[model samples]
Target: MGLLWGITLLWAFSFSLIGVYLAGQVDAYLAVASRMALALLVFLPFWRPLPWRQALVLMATGAIEIGIMYLFLYKSYQYLTVAELLLFTIFTPLYVSLFADLFARRWPKHLWAPALLAVAGAAVIRWTELSEDYWKGFALIQAANACFAFGQVWYRHQSKSTSLTHRARFAWFFLGALLVTALASALLADWQKLPVTPVQQGVLLWLGVVASGLGYLGWSYGSTLVSAQQLAVMNNMLIPAGIVVNVVIWQGQVDWLRLGLGSVCMAGALWLCRRQSS
Candidate 1:
């Protein structure tokens, strides 16, 4: 949980940094590829070969979680306002909860209420009127959300059975992500939009090394430490945390009433999950 919370705070600033510094200036595929490559470098030194099947599974999880998710997510930003993107992400907790159940081959009726509550909380913070033609953006975000949720659920379940520590085998995960993102960059990245400024370069370094590398390491491992309900609820914690960072550091506008109410709702969801675990 500490690792999870720490990474959440670390990533809270990432949204603003990307929106302010990299969104239009840098090619999204290139940024994704750069981040994955840097992250792979971080873990590569610690890599130990796993069973062929385990290695493939981790790679597949990485492909779905970060590679495909980032592809869908960055592309959707073109069609949706940042607010709309945030709003649509509220569904992620629901997806996480549902996917966990699907993977486990049984429904944990106990988890659903808190997952739905967390979604409601995030919606309160982020929901706004959608653009008339928002369906494409919505679909893209949902696909991203579903992929991310499924990946987390899959990894958590699989990690329980693996003898290798996460660090020993984690490089394979980023290698898989790099393969997808590198291919996408080769095919689709806008050459003219590559980062040219010192600020942009620095931001990418921070995002790649610290955010993508350490952040995902922490999040993936932390997901294995908690109940599925807790993990699902925790996914929504990023919404309020990111909003607060945007509001405080970036001077982004937010409705105080919604922020407060939504935060309370999120807190309640976490509390409910704690009670269930106890």
Candidate 2:
């Protein structure tokens, strides 16, 4: 849970940074490819052999979760405001809860209430008038959300190895992501849009090394420790956290009333889940 919380803060900054610094300035495919490549480099040294089956599963997880998901996310930014993108992701908790239950073949009914509450909290925080591109951006973000939710649940349940084993072989996950992103960048990227400025390059390096590499590792491992309900609720935490980052760093306008209300709702959701579990 602590790991998840820590990564949540780190990823909140990532959300703001990408939206402000990289989304429109850099080629989406190139950004994704570069990030994955850099992350791959970080883990490559620790790589070890795993059974063919486990290796394949982890690779597939990475490809879908980060590789394909980033494609949807980065492209959606062209059609959506950062706030809209964040708001649309409110559905992710529901997706996570549903996928976790489906994979387990048993419904933990208690999970649903808290998950729904978390979604409501996120919705409250970002509610606004809809633009013409709402449906398109919504669809793209939903696809990304579903893929991310599925990957987290699948990896948390399917990977039965000890922590040491997971670390030793985790590079394969990024390799799989790299294959997808690299292929996309090669085929679809606008070469003219590559990062040229020092800030862009530095941001890419930070995102790739610390955010993608360390953040994903922490998040994946953290998922193994918490209940699916807790993980589901935690997904919504990113919304307020990201908004706070934007407010602090980017001087983005924020509605204090809504922020306070949403925070209360999310806290209530967390408390409810914890009480139920206890």
Candidate 3:
């Protein structure tokens, strides 16, 4: 729980930073590749050999979750506002709950209500006029969300021996992500649009090392400590947290009434989940 909360705060600025600094100026594929490469490097020193099967699984998880997920996320910034992007991610909790139930081969039965409530709350937050690009961006973000949710649940449930710690094994995860992103960048990115400004380079470094590296480590570890229901509810925590960061740093205008009301609903949903667990 502490890990989740800490990462929530750390990640609060990530959306705004990407939207403001990297989205339009940097080639999305290149950005993704660079970020993953740096993160891979961060974990490489601690890397240990794992079974071929386990290594492959972690690699696939990273490719889908971080590699492809970032592909959708970065492209969506061209079409949607940061607020809309965050709002669309409200459905992630539902995806998380569904995937967890599927992977477990039995429904928890207690997760549905809270997950639905969280979705409803998120809908309320963005119930205003939308641009024509809404549906496209919405679909893209949903794909990213589903992949991310699946990865988190899958990693959380994996059985491992107590030999090497998770940190020691995480390099394979980022290595897989790097392969996907690097390939994508090589094939799709505009070489002419690489980061040139010092600020751009610095932001990329920060995102790769701090956000992708440490943030993922904390988030994945945190998922193991909480119930699936709690994890589902906590997935929505980023919406409000990101919004607060956007408003404070970028001075983005937000609907306070809607934000307050939606936050109440989400809070209520989280409370319900906690009560059920108790």
Q: TM-scores of the models, in the given order?
A: 0.98, 0.95, 0.93
User: Top lDDT: which candidate number?
Assistant: 1
lDDT of each residue in 150-250, candidate 2, tens digit only: 98998887766445466655698898899999998989999999899999999999999999999899999899888888999999898889889889989
lDDT string, candidate 3, 99-214, tens digits = 88998899569988899888888778766566775888888998999989998988887733335577876798899899988988888899999999999999999999999999
Q: lDDT winner between 2 and 3, please give it.
A: 2
lDDT of 1 by residue, 189-208 (tens): 88999899999999999999
Clashing pairs in 3: none
What is the clash tally of candidate 2? 0
Note the Cα lDDT for every prediction shown. 0.91, 0.88, 0.86
Off by over 4 Å in 2: 161-164
RMSD of each: 1.0, 1.5, 1.8
Ordered list by lDDT, greatest first: 1, 2, 3
Error of 1 at 217 (Å): 0.5
What TM-score would you give candidate 1 relative to the actual structure? 0.98
